[model samples]
Target: MTDIPLEHVHVAPEDGSDGEPAPAVFVLHGRGADEEDLLPVAAELPDDRHVVSLRAPDPLQGGYTWYELDLSAGGLESSQPDAADFRRSLDLIVESVEAAVDAYELDADRIGLLGFSQGAITSLSLLLEDPDRYAWVVALHGYLPESHADLDPDGIEGKPVFVGAGAGDRVIPDSRTSAAVERLEAVEAAVTHGSFPGGHGIGPQELEAVVEFVESQAR
Candidate 1:
């Protein structure tokens, strides 16, 4: 267990246009990556929107991980099982996002969560834990939380969700991908799922689908 302060960075559109309320996206990177890892992906999104790429709270040897995984405790891969710690970190992230939204006068209903790998897992967890926090969620190369059984889909209220996974992803098995879809559907989320030909990564097709989903939600 190591203690490291969470870090974050933001990337705004290059154009000098400003507005009373600017739509924004909260971008989370995969495990072993920092806020900078997702900066490039933000550029691929619609430039008219504001993008904030956040770093994980805990620092790893060369990167960062949102929570610790305990394979030693049976088959459980818990995410910072310490409830208080998890909530504290999650609160920090959420607070940062809300502050940014307020500063930009962005419509809360237009904000979305976009994450890859572990970040995707976190995005799903956050959406399920607090449905009204985000209007849309985009998860890439990740599976649903193991504790999906405890979630209340009715809380989601038909929020739009986009899930993209590789057909042959070894890290996140196809079965897990299917399970994730089922869970989202059960929660009454308006889901759009896409499968690519690669493994544990995002491709041009996947990115295109994500862009389309975000644009639709933004409108």
Candidate 2:
């Protein structure tokens, strides 16, 4: 199990000047990153919504992680984290989103998720398992987690999703990316897939695409 407990999360409040209940976007970081890690991306995103970033629950090396991993055991796709621990992380993310909505008076119809790597795992899991709660998703350099195998594909039809992957990423092979897209589409998610000419990380080009995707979703 993870040693670090998730008690505090970081949030960037929105300035809703239009006297409307602005939408809120929950930002989740990759493993080994903190709540503030994705704040810059949040800055680049549309400023119309509240940007709340969540930290994972487990401690690792000098950073934190969503769950334990066995990297050398044939890469991430085959490797699995503790199921119970994964479930808890999933629940905590949902709780954080709900709490933010209540505290900020956010529009219930405009909540979204943005995640990278392990954060992608958590965000994707929550959105897939409970499609009704999230309006859209943006997952960066990630694949489906093992615990999410039982999601009903028909549960999230017509939902918008943005998937950004690295074409040269040695960590998560293209096979995994293809599978992820297939799975999301099987559930009938309108996936706007983009590939960058990089390896295992998000680039400026990809971020531009993501920003465009986020804007389109808001409309």
Candidate 3:
């Protein structure tokens, strides 16, 4: 995969409550979704933090895709080029997060990641790949990659992880979600799992839980 330059959309919190540099939340959107879709939700988060919603690099049939897929090829197989692209994009994200941490003068230990659907999967992958990089991870309607069996358990030990999924989620099966939880637990992650009554999406209760999770980590 080519090392394409990275670009992002950033939203800073409104002024006046705390003098502390705001902790940042990096958001990733679902397949076929753009950076704009997740920014408003980031704004709704507690006002004490900075939020950045990133755009995927690979261009799909008119829109952007974090990776490539072939349905006929079966079972979540990402192209080599796409996987390489994702790795490069992830590296860029880490750099950006570090820069934001320094620029905002925020608590480095408080930085977090929040992702939806495909973004959520990416967040889980990144956290499992490099444990100490993020203080907390919030994944909504997403499951861990099947390839995670190869990851070293020590990488995610003691990391705080929050996962929310709908009992009726058609996109992500309950079995997959359960397996993800099991894998995370096996790795000694501090995991909190939530299940809502709806389908394949976030609801108010899930949002509240996420806010609480992040706030708790910030403190």
Candidate 4:
């Protein structure tokens, strides 16, 4: 796969202002999902925040993936990501975010990221790697990989972060959630984590909380 994600789309604001650059949100889908998967969530975000949904770089069975998964260690909790592709995808996402800012006249200082499952892993990976690059981050049904070690957690201070997970999620266990929280705390991030009643997918309550987070950060 190329170092760039293959597909993307911009969800423009209906009441956008002329000349004033709008704040933006980048939405990423989980494994086995497409760019169109998060469009409904995009449609629910605060109207002032422009949306960008991206497809993963590496194509899987019928869908796409940010990186290859290695579950040989057993269970989803012990899974590993292909280091090379993960880094490549991160580079591509950063490039895309930069390009989106320039092309859409977006406010770079106010950009937030939202991701689900594998998408969430990629999003949090980027945020932790360079905490200064994002205004906020929302990680859903995902956890931070122990392999990402170049981060200065202290730089994430005051940065808004929301971690939404399903209490009954067999895909992501509580151990992973706790580990993610510990990692984020080490960096001093302003975090809001919520666990709802569900499994591996996003629910209405999750959406509402995540939307509130992005909207609050955009303000």
lDDT top scorer:
4
> Which regions in candidate 2 have their CA more than 4 angstroms from the true location?
1-15, 70-73, 153-155
lDDT of every predicted structure (CA atoms): 0.75, 0.78, 0.74, 0.84
- Model 1: how far residue 35 lies from native, Å: 0.6
Cα lDDT for residue 151, model 2? 84
lDDT of 2 at 198: 93
lDDT of 2 at 32: 84
Evaluated at residue 199, the lDDT of candidate 4 is 89
TM-score-sorted candidate list, best first: 4, 2, 1, 3
* Model 2 error, position 19 (Å): 4.4
Q: Clash totals for all models, in order?
A: 0, 0, 0, 1
When summed lDDT is taken over every stretch of 10 residues in candidate 4, the lowest stretch is: 1-10
- Mind giving the per-residue lDDT tens digits that candidate 3 earns over 82-150? 456566767776776776666656667767899988788888888988888788898888777655545
Write one digit per residue (lDDT tens) for candidate 1, span 1-219.
Answer: 012234567566556355546667888898788888877777788776778777888888799877666454444322323444445656767877777776555667768899998788778888888888788899887776655436984558688999988987877665666678888888688889989888878888888888888878744
Top candidate by TM-score: 4
TM-score of each: 0.85, 0.89, 0.83, 0.93
Q: Put down candidate 2 lDDT per residue, 135-182, tens digits, no spaces.
A: 999988888866675587445988888888998987776567677888
Clashing pairs in 1: none
lDDT of 4 by residue, 79-197 (tens): 97878888888898999888888887889988889899998898899998888889999999899886774377557887888998899988887568767877787778888999888
